[model samples]
Target: MKKIDVIVKYFYPLAAGIEINVRNVYKHMVSHGWDVTIHTSTDMPEAKNSLPVIDHLDGMNIHRYPWRWYGFVPRIDWAHTPAIALHNFNIFPHSWLLIIVLIRRTLGMSSPKVFLTPHGGFTPEWRTFSPLSRFIKKTYQEILGVHLINAAVDGLRSVSDWEAVESIKHGMRPDIIHIIHNGLEREVYTQIEKLANQVTTDQVRKLGRYLIQIGRIHPIKNQATGIKALKHLPQDIQFVIIGPVTDPEYKKSLDLLISQLGLFDRVHFLGVISGVNKYYWLRHSVVNVHMALWESYCNVIHESMSQGCVCIVSRGTALEELIKDKINGFCVPEYDEVSVADAVKYILDSSHARQILAMRKRNTDFTRGHSWQNISLQVEKMYTTALGS
Candidate 1:
């Protein structure tokens, strides 16, 4: 059997949930007797200075490339820069570099099957800011060196149905797009149980329960609505926001709102807690509140439920597909702070009902079906089929 080569444009130290997916899938594929190599780039300072080469991580081969640094100087207001110009002048260079590396590796390999999992970066949401940005992305998709690299791939792997739909919109053959839900590491579930014990003991000392929200503090997540809804809740119940403050302006705005609403004490911003601390927060919280305007699939929801934490999510995008209202979790209308508050209050007041529901949902074993082991099996089948054809 030929080896499988997977090209992912973004990988590690980025710490997005997608990173977990990529890492686990790579490991799983290698364990299944598929020779897997992941070509990627790293922005970590230590990685930046080293020679760009392949290294063994877990069971897979990881090839890292040096990304061009535009300047040593950093700007305070980077988002203010025109996105289209940045896409054309900066991001495309990395995309092309990835293409060149893919071509070189593919030529030297023994007719290995190639796969590209863009990991949400190639979506319209990321590139469709302006007409020019859309035009440039479409042009690159159609005729650029990126397209040339894409053409060599046997199949395109998408993490969600939304991504598969987008791939078709971008002219990828529907039959060639495979929808695979990203998987959580088995360690996350184990850590959640350990965290529950710690948080439950600590909860005895603290006043009332907390509603937790986790993810990057960015405008795209619409966490401000979650902060706003905190005012509507009873004084006893607090809101805890845990995740990296990726956008300073957004964090500032959230801080201002917390002050204006007199929720300074009621709302806690726990910046970027990970590992055991992350699991502790999730396991301890009364309810996991995720009100993102758009998300392919919120891994936190799955992680929270794995720990038997009840979740309330916004009703839009693929969230509706992942969360069945009143079954696995509660779903609220978009931007309706009152609905969010109502759901939280119901979960708080009816703790027994909520726990029963959450436990039933958690016990359903949704994560088992979506495990990286199973996903890798599917991908291996695709690779074999691609090779045979």
Candidate 2:
């Protein structure tokens, strides 16, 4: 059977956006009878029981290798298989993987056709995020990264137009780039609807009339804006934040801000929710909010929209493409207390119940067709094109 291998920084037990997206894509691939194997770093201690561990998730194969001090080394045994390698993200671990693949090809050893997905890793903010990241990527791209991409990769997968533009700026050929929007599993809506039926009056009271924000708790997510907006919203309109704190310092800052604003009671953090409960919040929320510094594309925004919840998302990101200011959802013009507060208030006070219902219906109708199955089919076409080339 033909096989495709995925190379990413982390997988399973880690709920980063990219990991989830990859998992869903592979799952859909497996369902279509493609044998898919994921090659990723073993970042979670729980998944590190054995070296080069193999597991099955969503009917796809996952092979996790432990990370080394310098970087990752793809297993020598898998080299002979001559698989199609999909490299997710272009930094840290994947740089080493790409280099290793290049050297093997140079040595006339078996090598896989590579497909690169930068996942917005090359954004302008990347340079300011860390000095090492800037130096490593800049130095490598000039010397090796761009060269390897040009020589080894069959194509690039871009989640948004912004990412496609960035990839071109970084020296990838425009012809080989494919832009496919990210999508959620269709079952998410089913699970959420089921959970909505089970939601009782007591649960609603406990959850409160809150504006929910779901995503990894990192500095880039700008969760503080949501917390501050509580002061401007009605006292009963609380703020509920969901997702794991990927950055401890950012989490600490959010906690400090919550305390300073005397919103300890109004602001609730329910960390790392999934499945039915995750959708329950979105289905029942007054509105969902995401004020990220930027996004290649936000899966959570679609998740919220699919669950029929109107969203207040940050402007000037890929999210803007999903929302048309007050048409289907609200957009925060700026990530400030005033901007967020005003957006929330507009949704609350201005949008009539009937208009809000119409907006929700529009969102649900749009995202209902964006299933993983359809997305994977588009990817399968790309795979065929890659092989034909």
252: Cα error in model 2, Å: 1.2
User: Can you write out model 2's per-residue Cα lDDT over 109-131, one digit (the tens) per residue?
Assistant: 87777777777765545523688
Off by more than 4 A, model 1: 1-6, 33-37, 44-56, 59-63, 69-112, 126-135, 138-150, 188-207, 275-277, 351-364
TM-scores, in order shown?
0.76, 0.90
lDDT of each structure? 0.64, 0.76
Question: Largest TM-score belongs to which candidate?
Answer: 2
Clash pairs (backbone) in predicted model 1 = none
lDDT of 1 by residue, 60-125 (tens): 766666554422111112222111001111244435444544665557733334455666656635
- Model 2 vs. true fold: TM: 0.90
Give each model's clash number: 0, 0
